[model samples]
Target: MKFAGIGVLNAARKTIARMLGNNEIAYESAKSQFWVVDAKGLITEGRENIDPDALPFARNLKEMDRQGLREGARLVEVLSVKVVIFLLNFDF
Candidate 1:
């Protein structure tokens, strides 16, 4: 993914690395891990060290070609149900 400049990519990588290495945060687990995907939906960072059992979204992103990632990327979370329905039905 393309970004405003190399600074963005560097920053993203540093953030992910920090999160992964942070001792106070339970960011990495058997069921959880970090990933950096670009605007075009390609994995930019974290692919090289990804685990095989990562979430389906992470695994899918890893399959894309990061060589062509672009700018305007944003963090996203995938939900099992319609967002509105899920939010309304959720308790607490």
Candidate 2:
């Protein structure tokens, strides 16, 4: 956080991820853990009913035949994407 500085919200998320598991890194940030392969979209959970609030950042990965979201695949965070890409996409 020294260089980019730390946001309380982001930090809190990081801590949450650390506590949860490294695989859970994305959930810590406001980003989606999107795409579980062949799921058609970026939803965190592939199946089972979910409230919109449960995975708010999980951009739906539905096929075009399904309701398509224009800003699909965009989230404030994703786990371990390259630093450059992360910086480019980062937003408060």
Candidate 3:
């Protein structure tokens, strides 16, 4: 399974980390994958000022555009993950 989250600081990334760490949802058993996108864009390498909790989920910049995206619709369209979790209050 693939999961994409829209917000990182507002408890979304932490919750997912806890779930994966505690094995609460069998994410490992199913080989689920997770990605997080904060206000700037997809969390990628060299993204300054990243919350410590969100560092583990960050991916290489080469895999995605590092310029950043502002809209949730664009994020969904580009990531193409099986599930998208919007943990923040988005205007969309």
Candidate 4:
């Protein structure tokens, strides 16, 4: 189950990183950590993983960014129903 969780986390990281304009992503399976390199080759650590069940929701942040939920949505305070609703209904 732990390995499966790591897999899911890495997948989520990749999706979010790509959406963040990252051209390179590296996952260190040995440590369960990952980092992303943007188009300008700037490296930034990946976001910490959330509960396995909510992992899929990680991509919502990118969509929220597209809709201008925030000037630059770098972080999410909580990953819950409220966040889901905000992501689905927020307006600039």
Candidate 5:
């Protein structure tokens, strides 16, 4: 299963990171399962000005499908994500 988000929630990131670090969840198991899309697009490696909290989820672009780092509404359709949590409302 895969998950994607519009932005990284600091508290949520920390909690998930802790879960992975403590062996509650394996890193490899969570890699493709978690994703975040910021202003620059999907949180892939090489994206600049990445928040420290989001660093853990910065996956390699090649891991994604041919479309790669989709932005805004396109993310929903392209990734076929099942659930979307809107932490805040703002123009993408």
Candidate 6:
């Protein structure tokens, strides 16, 4: 999936990470996974600098070729990417 920038990605990533790490224990026995991306393109180990929060989920996941760059790329600007979950909810 795609995000806006370091700040945006960091905020959302840490939030989701907390949600995944906490909510799973809070609600169920299973675990959860999350992915984030932004203007510098896809988040990966190859990228020198990335949001600090994004570090946890930065499993060096594969990147698609067109995952290019833009001066001011927003989440909406992501031309294409793999699926990303934004709002995951549980009854509990």
Candidate No. with top TM-score: 5
Summed over model 6, clashes come to 0
Candidate 6 per-residue lDDT, tens place, 1-92, comes to 22335355445545765766755462222112334445344445666654554555443333323455343334454434435544222222
lDDT for model 1, please: 0.32
Give the range where candidate 6 is weakest over 10 consecutive residues by summed lDDT.
26-35
The model with the greater TM-score, 3 or 5, is 5
- Give candidate 6's TM-score: 0.35
Mind giving the per-residue lDDT tens digits that candidate 1 earns over 1-92?
22233344344435665767744342333113333333333233344533232222243433333422232133343221112111111112
Displacement of residue 63 (Cα, Å) in model 5 is 0.4
List RMSD in Å for every model shown.
13.8, 13.3, 8.5, 14.0, 6.7, 10.6
**Per-model TM-score versus the true fold:** 0.22, 0.24, 0.44, 0.24, 0.49, 0.35
Candidate 2: tens digits of C-alpha lDDT, residues 36-82: 21112233444354333334333444531253333223332222231
Global lDDT for candidate 4?
Answer: 0.33
What lDDT score belongs to each candidate, Candidate 1 first?
0.32, 0.34, 0.49, 0.33, 0.51, 0.43
Runs in model 5 lying further than 4 Å from the true structure: 1-25, 65-74, 81-92
Candidate 3 C-alpha lDDT tens digits along 1-92: 12234333334444655766746454332223555666665555577766665566565565444434332224665477435444342333
Model 1 TM-score, 2 decimals: 0.22
Candidate that beats the other on lDDT, 1 or 5, i.e. the better one: 5
Rank order by TM-score, top first? 5, 3, 6, 4, 2, 1
Which candidate comes out best when scored by lDDT? Answer: 5
Which candidate would rank higher by lDDT, 5 or 6?
5
Ranking by lDDT: 5, 3, 6, 2, 4, 1
Clashing pairs in 3: none
**Candidate 2: which pairs clash?**
40-61, 41-61, 42-61
Model 2, C-alpha of 14: deviation from truth (Å): 0.2
| Model 6: per-residue Cα lDDT at residue 75 | 47
